[model samples]
Target: MTPFQTLTGTAAPLLEKGKLMSNVDTDMIIPKQFLKTTTRTGLSKGLFHELKTRADGSENPDFVLNKPAYAKAGILIAGENFGCGSSREHAPWALLDQGITCVIAPSFADIFHNNCYKNGILPVRLPMDVCEQLAALAGGANHVFTVDLATQTLTTPDGVTHAFDVDPGRKSNLMAGLDEIGASLKVAGEISEFEHKRRLMTPWLEPAI
Candidate 1:
């Protein structure tokens, strides 16, 4: 996972018929068909598969992501309860593959919120009104937005800054680019020492190879 400190890029608003769609679940972000792969590579092709694809398997030009201007958006402005439903890590994987690193919404599923941090994605929670304002700004000609994890602030295209809160540990891990595995490796020396002592103290607990 890449370290996240400050990100400056265009924001894509995930809207349906000019209105923000609520309860944007994981299946909507990346359908179950795309969850076959354990690795994160090539998942971008399946990101928002349903929304971006038409009934005849053609591209849905009306979708926000399919729009040329938002094709490479690095941030997403979404509605409440985003990333709901199943707890699939692939959701963030697909988003990251699609070059999206930050998602702003009024709220998010607990599991999905934690998964975002583990994958180096910043999921910001703000008031619904604030998110709507941000989405409107993102749809404008000047759609660039800046998110500073170190400062816990999001700067809109119009120069207004909004503050948000995040867990200290998660914030630290993101800033250091430390995923769960990476974080555990940081204490490898201590783990090895403890294992060595455990073997001597209770050899019977060891499994037979």
Candidate 2:
């Protein structure tokens, strides 16, 4: 996973009436038509493509992401069950490709949340009221927000702050830029020691080189 330090950028509101519509699934995030490629490149264009386009293929100017103020948004504040569809790593990849570094939501699907962490996207689970408040703040003109992973705090442009929680192991992995394999490699010395002991204890099972 790419290391995440602090992310400071404009945040967009993916909510309605101070709340986000629930069950914003992975299919809705990238849609089935855009899932052809395994590569992460060019996935940004597929992000919210269906929602941002009409049947006639014209842009939907009313879409939050299509709005001028949110075009370059890096943080997305949403509601419950933010990612509640198929278990696909591509979902987070698409969001990252669009420059969305963090997502603040009331809740998220288990698989989706794990995928987000693996892909270097911070998936914050705040209370519903807190998410609503953050969403409202995100609506301000060009409002900027900072997510400090080290401190586990989110600071808004108007000086308001919110504290959040992240699993210590996950936090460490993100901070150290280590994926699962990379994290395991951090204990390579211990692994070698274990192997040596195993070889000595079970010499009859050893294979000839």
Candidate 3:
């Protein structure tokens, strides 16, 4: 995980106007066929595979992601209840692999939200109306947006600002590029000291050398 301080890039609307595609599960984000790989490589090709393809595996130009302007979009302004299904870390992995560093939505699945932070993706949660406005703005010209995690704010290309909040511990971990294990290891000295004291107090619990 790399420390995520700020991301400034093109913001693309994940859906059209008034078409709120809620409850977008991990399976839909990346189908079961794509879950065979344990590695992050090659997952991007499967992103929204079902939605972005036709019955005969043809490219669906109608899909928002298939559009030329959004092809390389790094920030996704999405609807509510996004990522609402199974807890698959691969969802964020695929997004990150596809160069999406941030996701702005009204709501997200709990596990998916946590996975985003672990994988160096910033998941911004804003009010539904705010998200709708951002989505609308993203659809028009001026789609570029900036997300400053340090400031906990989202800045639209037109200078509009929206405040957001994240867990302080998560924020610290993200800034330092530390995952759960990395965070725990940050106090390794204390852990080692405690273990040493425990061994001295309970010598019989120690294995024979």
Candidate 1 runs further than 4 Å off: 197-209
| Model 3 lowest lDDT segment of ten | 14-23
Measured with C-alpha atoms, the lDDT of residue 21 in candidate 3 is: 67
Order of models, best TM-score first: 3, 2, 1
RMSD of each: 1.7, 1.7, 1.6
* Candidate 2 segments whose C-alpha is farther than 4 A from its true place: 16-18, 204-209
* lDDT by residue (tens digit), candidate 3, 1-209: 88999988888777744565667889998888888889987899999898889999899998878898888899988888888889988899999888898998889999999899889998999988898889888888778899999999999988999999999999999999999999999999999999999999999999999
Q: What is the lDDT, from 0 to 100, of the residue 110 in candidate 2?
A: 98
Location of the lowest summed lDDT over 10 successive residues in candidate 1: 13-22
Q: Give candidate 2's TM-score.
A: 0.94
Clashing pairs in 3: none
- Model 3 segments more than 4 A misplaced: 204-209
Models 1 onward score TM values of: 0.93, 0.94, 0.94
Q: How many residue pairs clash per model?
A: 0, 0, 0
lDDT string for model 2 (1-209, tens) is: 67898999989888655457688999989988888999997998888887788999999887789988888899998889999989978899999999998999989999999998888899998999888888778787647999999999999988988999999999999988887889999999999999999999999889888
